[model samples]
Target: MSEVIANMSMSLDGFVADTNDGIEQVFGWYGSGDVAVPTAVEWATFRTSEASAGVLRHGLATIGALIGGRRLFDLASGWNGQHPMGVPVFIVTHQEPTDWAHPEAPFTFVTDGIESAVAKAKAAAGDKNVAVASPTVVQQCLDAGLLDAVQVDLVPVLLGQGIPFFGELAKGPVQLDGPTVVEGQGVTHLTYRVRR
Candidate 1:
């Protein structure tokens, strides 16, 4: 059996990505130094905080598979054939992109729905955890009672407007516990258990 965990790094104001502005500000803490066109590996490996790196390492180690949304897939187009997580990723999308269907790519586009995507991800994960990295997918899982835990790396910044992590919770009011707050250098990790 595998647990479904939704994780994200959000601003203090609860914004995930600053819409047209992008997520560079919200996630700036993840990386450091400016380079002339850094590779996807460099983009993924740069770390400003060792604690944040530890958290990410722990997450990647515990999770066997990842589930994301179409927009996220598009944003991470640089991953191409090699993914940073080194695990199969299930992407929820309305339609599969033709150019993205590489045989060597560790990605599966689930056109059916979030549940179907999650089912496949869980199967792939086996006894480990299945991580939902997209906010939309996380909300869908929360609504459908498919999410087991919610983890947010709370960054100390205020994005006036942007994509939010929570939207139209279909399951109504979801009670959270612990929040198991851990203070890092640049971010605070908040882990909450979704009460059924």
Candidate 2:
């Protein structure tokens, strides 16, 4: 069975990025430590604490597919055609990109809806998990009751206001259980299963 998990590094104040769409404040932990964690993409290796490295390696090994919003896709410039996770990426968008350079890449532009994207990603994942990478997609998954778990790489900072990790859920008050915690140098990894 493939479970859908929402994962992101968030600020202590609950923002994922600053008002200018900057993530330096929240993503500093990726390079703040001594342990090296390489990804599928050669340009984006992470240097984090040993604990965070373990968590990143575990996710890289287990997550089979990724679901993200079009906004994030554009922000990352389609991750140069290959995402760091080396998994298939399913982008939820109203329309496909007209001049996408990486047509041969394993990127699927899903214009129908989140449900359809999830179905395709799950089938692609086989027995592994589908990771939701965008905050908007996470919110949608929460509203649709499709998210199974939430993984928060909590960074210690107060952004005060910016792009939040969560938004107005159509289905409010989602309950979660058992935040298995792992402390890192400047961040804390927390995983909570969604209560059914």
Candidate 3:
């Protein structure tokens, strides 16, 4: 009974990552590439209203697991197996990771395919939400008709040449429900229920 969700921060122009732009530039707002792993005080405070907290605690309390793509895995440098929420992450990849970048924070790489990875993540998620956190996996889930909802933090900047967050889905015009916009300092969080 877990709902599959795909979420990410995208520029107003609809790009998740910039063209050849490093993680620091595209995802710098989160602190660093290992933004997934929050520090001790960050955990202690548990304050959602903090000025620097951009949807920080939004779904952190609900998500039970995460699914991401290979490119996102590489770009994020594997988050060194450290995720802010301490949830298990399943990486959908054709090739396995060659390095154990983060010993303490580890990732589970699924090679079978996106569906398989999602299935595993969903099972692991119990009754909580299984978040499809990578762009490629999100598109695949949408194409495969697996995702239940899509959440995006719409950033104000326009990265014109980066990889697109969404474009030409396998099916034409994926209908969306309420934007349910939540305004913050640097970004706006938008959530949509994918109309089947």
**Top model by TM-score, which number?**
2
lDDT of 1 by residue, 1-196 (tens): 6899988889999888997838887777677422222223544564555666667767767889989998888887726756777788888999988886476777888999988998999999989899897778888898889989999989889988998988878768899888887777668999999998
**TM-scores for candidates 1 onward, in order:** 0.90, 0.98, 0.83
- Indicate whether candidate 1 or candidate 2 has the larger TM-score: 2
Q: Sorted on lDDT, highest at the top, how do the candidates line up?
A: 2, 1, 3
Local distance difference test, per candidate? 0.81, 0.95, 0.74
Clashes of each: 0, 0, 4
**The CA-based lDDT of model 2 is what?**
0.95
Clashes of 2: 0
Query: Which residue segments of model 2 deviate by more than 4 Å?
Result: none
Q: lDDT (0-100) at residue 85 of candidate 1?
A: 72
lDDT per residue as tens, model 3, 69-161: 888777766765676667888989888867666655546889998889988998888889888876778889999989889988777787767
Q: What is the lDDT of residue 149 in candidate 1?
A: 92
Q: Write the per-residue lDDT of candidate 2 for residues 97-170, one digit (tens) a residue.
A: 99899999999999999999999999999999999988899999999999999999999999999999999988
Q: What is the lDDT of residue 170 in candidate 2?
A: 89
In model 3, which residue pairs have backbone atoms overlapping below 3 Å?
Answer: 36-84, 81-105, 81-106, 82-105
